[model samples]
Target chain A: MATVAGHPETPLIEPVDRGEGLGHSIVRALSHAPLTILLAFIGVMWLVPTLGLFFTSLLPASVISSEGWWTIFSTPSNATLENYRNIFSDEAITSALLTTVWISIGSTILPIIVAALAAYAFAWMDFPGRDWLFIGVIAMIVVPIQMALIPIFSLYDRVHLFDTLAGLILFHTAFGLPLAIFLLRNFFVGIPGELLEAARIDGASEIRIFTRLILPLSWPAIASLAIFQFLWTWNDLIVALSLARSTQPITVAIFTQLRQFGANIEIIAPAAFLSLTIPLVVFFAFQRYFVQGLLAGSVK
Target chain B: MTDSSITAEPPNQGAPPTADEAGADPGRRRRFLVALGFLAPALVFLGVWIVYPTVYTVVRSFYDRSGDAFVGLDNYGTLFTTDILLTAIRNNAIWVLVVPAVVTAIGLVFGVLTERIRWSVAFKTAVFMPMAISMFAAGVIWHIMYTQDPSQGTINAAVRVVSDAVNPPGVLSGAAPSGDDLRGSAAQGYRLQGELKAGEVAHLGLTRIPASEVKDGVQAVVPATVEGGITGVVWRDFKPGGGGTAGEVEDGEVGIPGVTLRLTDASGAEVATATSGADGVFTFPDVGDASYRLGIASETFRESYGGVSWLGPRLITPAIIIAYIWVWAGFAMVVIAAGLAAIPRDVLEAARTDGATEWQVFRRVTAPLLAPVLSVVFITMIINVLKVFDIVLSVAPPSVQDDANVIALAMWRTSFGGVNDFGLGSAIAVFLFLLVIPVLLLNVRRFRREA
Candidate 1:
């Protein structure tokens, strides 16, 4: 909160400075108008293609092939939900959705449980070689999953984790741990020491102190990190592509179908919407926690 | 509170042990055990999944395709020698050089612009929407935009819409004459049959322009000509009929309008030139009553504004990279905006009050202040781009996948994607790892410094 910002404080009438009087809202708007316009353009530029995709998916497939999504505005009656119907009926996509949901949820739960414990230990426990160990774990964040891909493929083949949902959960958990541990440990380190001290005075064990004292205080951080981990694992394609066989995540299924035949707009458009909507919904629902988690790591 | 905790000694600091804390020294060992227990699961996964595989890949890079034979350095050799892999390496090099800076720059722009804006939250949310979708999904959306057909592709359709109004394409799209009456020479399309009498009507049947593309029921206007001038009707001679005479225009056939034909004498000397009318009829003015051949000018038949070949081999890499930017530029914006939010308003305000323009403030003050966050974003993007796989694989069509291949996708293809050459895959994995190490070390150093 005390981080130095690049803009200077200006003399402004705070709302509370003059109760029932004018606030700084209008003055602030006038001052920041140009920058707001720039940001507005950038935001629209970013969203237009996605908006096009969404609108295009809503229109009937026959309309989609011959006209741009922009045409829907001119001829509003042409839109339909047939694309969604097509996607929902596909057996392959449904199974892929199930696999993706299980993988995302599994990856999220496993990492949070394991990372919370490890992060608590790293933050509070006076363990031998803790810095070296924590540093090593943090360093793994930079080692991309690609480096381990080929060998892991062979390893999965040997161990029978190949083509299994458990295999994906395990891989996602391992990758998720570094950031989870880093973010959680940093958050855990900042907890008021008096809470732990009071628990200690009550003759509580370390487990009791951690569970009773730290976990409740760490919920906001934990929630945000979970959203991040879940979003990543859910939207992942490379890991699923490398590790899974027989049962594939939705991303990989979309990839294979699009690659094999990209011509099917009714299928690809709706399948894409189905794939993106889940994470986007998860994202919007937890917007505060997501931003809190992102800023927690960066605000340092 | 944190400062107090860091400075204040614990209540039990002076005592070795109390009744409730008996064997506290041995408890150090117990604490270590507890820490070890907590850390075990993650370590096990990391060791099996990351550390061991990394070392194995490094060693496996030395072997041959099957991983059974011990062929030291040959896999590494093939990385340099193989055409596809070398192209992959070269393409990865381009990707590494380009994508990170571009994404980070955009992120920086949005981040700084939204700093003082009232609607920054909504703007940031909108920009970050792409970050929610998988790169595969982004690729799908862009595949729709980059389709070869203009009617289906959003980008090309937009281009066609805008370009058609401002710069309408010339008539007579690269169509040519067909049949025995007029045959093409190396220089001109469809030279006149045998020899030409001065006043004979020349009928040159053409193909390449289908009957449906031509305008129907258009009357031919043959301009009046003086003595010894050539007159011709160069319409789309073929009809919608399943079969027809080769060089004769039938009912409902339309003219190949705006075509220009030339008169060449026996010695190939230039004569007069006349452009075809809107209805494919043309007349050259007075000539000295000499025999001449009317040949179609190649320029007359050539078409302009063929839509951009987004999936062609030449443009495939950049096209896919555009899709990548469409997805990731938003990611960059969101992350950098987080960093931007942490910037105090005082510095930028001071810079602006000191009479610096907005652009100057951005470049000198704001950019320098954002260096830490910008570096973090840049380094992370560099690492991500080095291992880029899914976008390239999904976005680039099979015809041009080799051109758009990055090391990570290349590695997949070499090993599990039909080629099944683990050694080559391992080498690529190792190569990618080595390439990422410097920036990874830079990032680790930054994080450590921040910590």
Candidate 2:
């Protein structure tokens, strides 16, 4: 995910002015139509490779190699539900789904709760080193996560958090917080001061105001951040591979299933589809707020 | 309910009370503790998981593999010379150089192009769908698509269809001469030893190709040689039961078409070259009476229309980057699209009315304006590519995984798994962190400038 500045400077793209004669302008309009078709064509071309695999994954592996995947269009019965069924019947795959769900939920929720507090402080509270501390937190965004894995992994062993779901949850939370705070604090600061002022006048404690006012009103921001964290932790492989060992999450599970020659489509296609499809569904469903979270980072 | 409840005041708008002035020592201490309390969990996690470990890595990098004896900078030095690490660095340079610029450029185009289209939402959603897939899964998909076998890999299959149409299929590997009767070296293919007359036909047989694999269905036809012409059959020499003589043409052996025959003079100087036909026979007609030795050129062994080896040690990094670009270009597009949406139309119209063409407007107006979004996307991609691990791990075959390794993956494999060389891994980690500083600094500088 990246961000766009919402600065007052207007974006620089526009349809060309066409004040010429009607014949010339008709030429422009017809030209515009082709351009539209060209863009759409490029979009579909961009999509076809992934689309090809998706389609192939639906067919039996026997059918996949014999004929072109596109041949299935003419011969519709070639597709099968076997791969998706195999994912559930297989013991390793089914449990990986559970692990991924548990980790995604834990990793998303804890950081938001923790970062909400930190964000509120950064947004509103007066404290020594607030700017520097907030800057320090956000600066960690640039540090490659590899820098922390080994030492912290050993540290986790000493603390007995290694190879545990809780360890990875904490790991995601640590890594997730800085970006969450940066995003959430930006949102929290933009809330009208008068609304908070009124609550303060009503004798609301800091905790009460945070829960009653900030938390309730900041749902969109929180939701956006939650979806992002969920997708990230859900799709993560390196962390889960390096840490947690009892059972695999889908990311690592699919990775481990890979053979030396190539992937097993029966497992990878459906498994990947299952892994990719869920968050995409989540993303599209909550997309209104999702873009808000995305834009928050750079708009400031 | 109470005056005490009202004591936790918001920042007073009129004249904010200084920590010491209006609030006595106890009150100031209370505010400090509350702020610390709010920050505690975040601080604790960041400390244990990120800060402390980062500091630990830096310290450990100076020590030996067990992190016991101090061997200052030795790990770092090892990183420079280690083949995999150096390759990782070089590959990352490729990633840094190629992926971001290409992704940003494509995204910039998509952002601009989609602006003119009506189905922008559907288009963007389609493009950005790959972001939902993990790099591991993406690796699986792309790996399948890049399969070397035409039956399995979509890319190679398409290439096969196109190349088969446009060019003749020269046998790619698996076909070679099988006998001591094949008298030529690897540099030159075999020739008939006992042949006396130039007008006679001599047969040259190869053994590796199955009869069914010959390019055309027609049977091999040996033609009578013209004056000074040398004609021979290059067919697979072996038969299934070992009944066929060594280096002699046997049934069920396929002809190796497209083998070049070089006829050299007795002085071993000038020679003529002629390629075989579909039936493994070639003719070289000449004028002079000097006897010439016939030899097979090396090109016959090569696979005709063979697709490039995308997963080979050299190309694996670029292949993975193509996958990475497919996954992220849409993301860049969406971010830039948002930036594009922020642009005011008036200036664009003004430029248009002032006689600037569409290309000029795009280059001068849209591009310059979208630089911030582009830079942000580029920097983020730089950050991402530096830490790329999953695809390299998942996509590269275990045999060549070392060849395709990135810094992050190298760090993992070096320290743990089997190596247990935490010192070297930490050094790599530290090396990666240093590599990231320039982008981080660039991002920080941009943020400060904007702030």
Scored by CA lDDT, what does every candidate get?
A: 0.74, 0.75
lDDT of 1 by residue, A1-300 (tens): 123332333222212222222223433453565656766776777787788889888988778877778889889998888778877888898999999999999999999988998887877776667777777776777787877888878888899988898888999998888878877887787777667777777989878877888899989888988988888888898888878876888888777777675367777778888889998998889888876665544311
Candidate 2 CAPRI assessment class: acceptable
Superpose all Cα atoms of candidate 2 onto the true structure and report the RMSD in Å to 1 decimal.
7.7
Interface DockQ per candidate: 0.32, 0.34
Candidate 2 regions exceeding 4 Å error are: A1-34, A63-68, A259-263, A298-300, B1-22, B170-304, B442-451
* Model 2, CA-based lDDT: 0.75
Q: Chain A TM-scores, one per candidate?
A: 0.86, 0.87
Off by over 4 Å in 1: A1-42, A55-78, A261-263, A295-300, B1-23, B115-122, B161-167, B172-304, B447-451
iRMSD (Å), candidate 1: 8.6
